[model samples]
Target: MAELPLSGLLVLDFSQFLAGPSCALRLADLGADVVKVERPQGGDLCRQLYVADLALDGDSALFHTINRNKRSVAADLKDPADLEAVKRLVARADVMIHNFRPGVMERLGLGFDAVAALNPRLVYGAVSGYGDEGPWRDKPGQDLLVQSLSGFVWLSGNADQGPTPAGVSVTDILTGAHLAQGILAALVRRGVTGRGGRVDVSLMESALDMQFEQLTTFLNTDRAQPRRSAVAHANVHIAAPYGVYQTADGYLALAMTPVDRLAELLDCAALEPFRDRSTWFIERDAIKAVIADHLMTRPTADWLAVLEAAGVWAAEVMTWPRLVEHDAFKALDVTQLIESAGGGTLLTTRCPIRIDGRILTSPRGAPRLGADTAAMLEEPMLDGNARVGE
Candidate 1:
């Protein structure tokens, strides 16, 4: 029943794809009034970015997932009238987010300096493939490309396997999270100084930050490339038993546990020689091979029962169907239902943050293209020098 943290702030989302829009989504989740400023022609290109060929209402499910609980106002930045309207909106916005290439927004006359001139308290956030003025600045800031360039693929999969990217858009999601963090920090600073600042994040930088543990180890060590375990590979830098192994029936994941304890627990004589802690990383592949072969003797449930009983960090690797059906997942109450444009409910995740022991839930779905354009333009203050939301 507590009021949301960002209740009165106005956020203008100018980006089309994942990173910038996702940051806006989080702000919207926290009760910020977020408005998507999109091109009138097609709205967000993500509206057509269908995943699993799924569409919700008129837009792709992917677009709906990131854009729910937000309003939309369409504009053509090149058109004088639309540009003026957007500038007015920017003048009233507390935060403005975009993922255009370094100089694109500058060319559009809506760059940070220009917007800052209109609203000194506006937090300007930008997302890119790489930092501005870098060779990669012009490269498309897509998730997969950033992951491939940031050495993230090398950290996953086995040494013998081909480079494998994560199934999800990990870089884009993390970059969005990083941008949100930077925006929040800037907002806090603005509360103190009465001035807003620019926050910049790149998918490549976020991808590197995600590997801080392994990257730091690589930097401090001999600087050799990390080698993934040939068997049950999970973490590139971790020792044996830190991976998912195939049981007789299904998969079981094991975290860091003492080899001698695991040997005694599983009654595997092969692991008796690996009791020395220092040799774990050096002999990880060999140890993982033995563990892999031994674990295949029992089903995942049997291993989980023994491991859980012994207080070992182990679990059955579950599929999405199994995970969603489990009581533990159900208890989290992670999903919410939003009413779509046509009066049907669309199931999506609720905001994960808990405030005052209450979860934030909203039934608002993504808006139609330019759904709020007239209303926004018709706001009485938009016609004058006065800030609209102020």
Candidate 2:
């Protein structure tokens, strides 16, 4: 069979929590051999991140979601024996990932320079809160804090409400993608140079990068930074009649920004009222005001059918259940279910990419703390003796 992209690569995942662990998870998903290094007890802190009822299960949904397809080895770094074991693991790993506060690794004797001396072919990836140096460097940063710091919190959500927490871990997810890219780039560099590289990414950097388009305009112009817009738009300033419209039962989105399209979609006599002058951008806010009042009459379902028939760019609001039940989703059915421990199955969304007509889906299961401890500790001892079962 053909080689998996990262088949021979080995990763030492010293990171816990969302961003760094999720990056390691992606590498594991792509067939890299990833060994997650965890504390001798308790494992990653994310194991306790959710609602309290699941505490009895001894496994967290978050932990399981981001930590599949990897083996786990537990160690107490302060102990000399454990530290020696970790050093041995680092010697064999192609990549090392960590998201500790700035000096924590150095304090633990696993700093990049120290490890790199032992293993020059190691790709060291680190994710942190603010960055290595900044006003918030030593201070802790989480998804909520960074979300508010980045204008994303204000940029999204309804105009009437104060900034609300995004339901998902936006910064962590973005940072994870960046971390993945950095690791992959290092891997590429290592292939050519025959030496590994150190790749450092931060949540703050990734969070700020997420607002590139908004920041570009705001910084260059005297205009006040755009705040909460009721609608989610790719080009918010240019969008008109460009929001979710209510139908009899649900919502149908309208992206009728182009004047001719807007005119036809709204079924109006003329858009002369909107195209008052060259200051149409200025008039857009008020135009939406008028259009909003008109859309108030119809329910979302009715508007959806009308828009669909009219060939207008529109989509019905998809709740979680709605998305699952949507015809396109049902027809395509991208997500799959995997059996878990205790004879239960876990439903999960599938990975997006396809390779030569094949979609790679790894077995999904949570680690049993230090379940791979014996195998990991004996890799060196077993050496040639380490057959598939060993």
Candidate 3:
């Protein structure tokens, strides 16, 4: 079959942090030629995110997930010579990606306007903390800050307790995803017009976009923020019998959305109270309490098996180890064994979608710091006229 969509595209990635590198990674996965440009001394900060004090001998897990299928070139952009070389690289590139603050690249004389002038076909991709320019533009915008600003962090944790931040770097991931989308769209437009355009993505914007429903609700209503639905937050709510129930075996979430199904699955006397949608809140609270009491009587596994068999969606709330080991996980190809430090294998979550039934990209290890610097930065100094060698 033909190579993945971006085969002939050349992406010069001047990004180290999550958002920028992730977009390059996505392009790499699609078979684009992605060359990561990093500083000579430490390279991308991400390489040290998980395991501090990292070296080429030990790439961090956080780095590997977003940097695979990319080649690295170490160059000190502050040096005039190296900066010129990057311009040369951009002149020949189909895409240039960066996550530096608004004017950083411009100060280095490597901004989109200059590079685009050099190569009309170059697609410039930029990711910012707040935006290129705004009241909050100069403020440091990390994933944590974006999460807190976007209301994502506010909804997390239980309703009663202070909101807990998501364990993962969701804002970075969301921004990266948006950057990839913008790049793809720009590529399509460039194909039609024979001129590439700038693709801008902001973490603040992406995070807010992600909270679409909540934002929309607040926009139209008087509520300042979305009230967390009690039934949805607690896997087991006192008012809804459909939430997860406990058993002597294990915990399994109850799939009792429909009133009839809830009644039948829970073996309750009736669900007339549920039919009155106006009071789902009141009814859900009471019903959840009853379900909780009933579930406490059995083992989790027993409850899960009974509920699942009865067509109520249910699964054991699995731990990381148990989840990967579960037969269902194996059947679904949701995990892959990747080579970690010491040549030992570590289980990593596979990408959510499968292409042609393939779960993970064929085990290309993360590039060591500036591993390709020698080959990349070496002078291949033929002028454009002579380089073509027609």
TM-score of 1: 0.96
Which candidate's lDDT is highest? 1
Candidate 3 structure quality by residue, lDDT tens digits, 185-241: 999999999999999999999998987866776778786754443433543222354
Model 1 agreement with the true structure over 310-380: per-residue lDDT tens digits: 99999889999999999999999999887666676778888888777777778888888888888776564
Off by over 4 Å in 3: 51-56, 229-246, 269-275, 336-353, 356-360, 381-390
Task: Give the per-residue lDDT of model 2 (tens digit) for 1-390.
Answer: 454577777888888889998898778666677878899878888877764454324676667777766777898889999999889889888999999999999998899999999899999999999999978998776988998877677765557667766788989988988999999998998899989888998888898898888788888887796754454332445556666655456666767556455656666544657754454455555665655565667777666666678777878777888788778888765766644454555566555555555665654555678877788875642221111111
Q: If scored against the real structure, what TM-score would every candidate get?
A: 0.96, 0.90, 0.87
Judge candidate 1 at residue 364 and give its lDDT. Answer: 81
Residue 78 in candidate 2, Cα distance off native in Å: 1.3
Q: Report the CA-based lDDT of candidate 3 relative to the real structure.
A: 0.72
Model 2 poorest 10 in a row by lDDT: 381-390
Better of 1 and 2 by TM-score: 1
Model 2, residue 256: C-alpha shift (Å): 5.2
User: What's the lDDT for all of these models?
Assistant: 0.88, 0.74, 0.72
